[model samples]
Target chain A: MVRLITHNLLACHVKGCTTNNFPLVFQDVQVELQVAEFNPDFIRNMLSRLEWTALVNAAKQVGDTSLPPEQPDMMDDELLQKLHHVLMEIHVTDGAMVCQNCNHIYPISNGIPNMLLAEHEIG
Target chain B: MIPTPDLSHLTRHDLEQVYDPAEDTFLLLDALEQEAEALRKERPLICLEVGSGSGCVSAFLGKIFGQSSSLYLCTDINKHATRCTLATGKQNKILLDPITCSLAGPLSSRLCHAVDVLLFNPPYVPTDTDEASSAQSSADIAGSWAGGIDGMEITNRLLQDVECLLSPRGRFYLVALKQNDVPSIQSRMLEDFGLTSQVVIERRAGREFLLIIRFARTAHSGSGSTS
Candidate 1:
């Protein structure tokens, strides 16, 4: 899942299952980038839903390869382009996304993340 | 460089049982093995062969890649295909160890989200009388080819389940016939999954060229239908 969308639905699957568990935050991410064409509209449309801090931090944890450390205060065309590439173009084909709080690992394979929980892990 | 396996001495029927290996297979195999070897020190390598006809490529691949201590899983919708791969492994003095040789469905939990590299050469030819005949004459009905009217019948099904088998740090190499509807697949991956993919290798075959696609991310959202 894109950090933009992974941020939306991920809640800690702990017993409480509270809203705060959301964004399950990234820790020690190892990022790999494969360049892709930029599509501005897609980024603009996705802006409202993104967890700004989470996206920025996850990008860093994965690797400081690209993307600014912080989201800009204003949405400039150039900045939006960066965000576009980060969200849509950069490839995260491989790597594990470990949740900060629950330590749940979501493995990304061939660029697809497996979010399914084990039978015992299911609430 | 890895040792090249001996691919000679098979009888005509034996070769017939072994599906035609695409020319691109060699090129992609070379490149993929290079990348895979680089990471051998870091992780136990896992490779999957999709639609592995006669499973020779997987056997060859397993022999080469597994030489330095990596795990190889050869899978095909057809059990016969995997058997063929296993047969070659037996003859080549490769994959003698139980842990190193395996054949199963793409959906098996063992493979779910656990592959390092996936090599696929699907039957993308539009369904025709020949394919139907092929399916009918097979000892096993399911393993034969039922690519639907367009020949992408199995391709779509494979794609959906493939994501689950990919390891977090894995890469996939998918081979499709030239006339196959690639745009449909790409759009599904890009728009629905929010992935960026590329045609990494191409081998021209008459009017149609076999394409090798590499998916860089999963689909975030989109319509998934078995139709």
Candidate 2:
């Protein structure tokens, strides 16, 4: 599945494009909701590592407006459920991730993202 | 007076004998095993064991999943503990990358790669009022247990840093004593952090208890938010 975590680590592999290659801009995304369990402690621990603004924007693009504009001091079940959905269930089954920096595009098919570079792009 | 079993004899093969299973190890192992099985569904995985003592359990897990290309990272807060644990894992034919560091220590980004499974059998015993009788002498002994006054000391801090290392769909398991204020912990997780939880195991013996907890990946719907 094209998970947000995988999405977070990906960057444009295009040649001569180094700076700001990450936080790939999602375009024409197809979101799929799959049920998963929740672990609050894990999520609490993960808060420090998340890109809140980017995740919220991406989720909004996919019609999921569950996250708060700001992170809450208290992690209530209600907020957790929303965070849970945004982080785990929303799968990008089909779409293209366009790089904000180099404008390089990576395609997603059958839920698997193609992160491979073209023959000439390989270093 | 009958001489207490020699620490050397008790700790012979591994640290497994350091604590009575009924009191500590069994509860933690129960929780670790429960989550380990679920994580195994994604075969050929890499598991991280935080606060791994003597590396016995990780070794056992490595053996079970080693045939399928799984590797275990057994870590501890002290260097000597890591050495001992690594030696045991190696002797038992378990693939392990042993790291010696504190729970709050920094890890290299390479070592912090997205992990499929995270297990913790942290020190969950509260300190006694009598400092003389407390097990807070050695760093290993102190790090091994002494969870503040309530037994959530190290564990509480450890949970906050796990997100950076967790892979998508990664599973987490924590084994804590029945007296460790589970409801408060759950509430803290559900309320303060955005995560869901399930009680996988609970052993009831009058006032005492042991809980096996499992958490979902960070992203998933049903935050039940009012906003």
Tell me the tens digit of each residue's lDDT in model 1 across A3-88.
33233323445333434444555543445564544545545644553567667765555554355656666777888777755664
Q: Name the lDDT value of residue B76 in candidate 2.
A: 70
Error of 2 at A54 (Å): 28
**Candidate 2 — which residues are off by over 4 angstroms?**
A1-123, B1-23, B31-37, B108-113, B128-138, B204-208, B218-227
lDDT of 2 by residue, A1-123 (tens): 455644544456566776776677888888887675565554555555566777777777778788888777898888877876777667787888888887877776555454545445643
Q: Which ten residues in a row have the lowest lDDT in candidate 2 chain B?
A: B1-10
Cα lDDT of candidate 1 equals 0.53
What is the DockQ of the complex in model 2?
A: 0.02
- Poorest lDDT segment (10 consecutive residues) of candidate 1 chain B: B97-106
Which residue pairs collide, candidate 1? Answer: A29-A62, A31-A62, A94-B168, A95-B168, A108-B168, A109-B167, B113-B164, B192-B221, B193-B219, B193-B220
TM-score of 2: 0.53
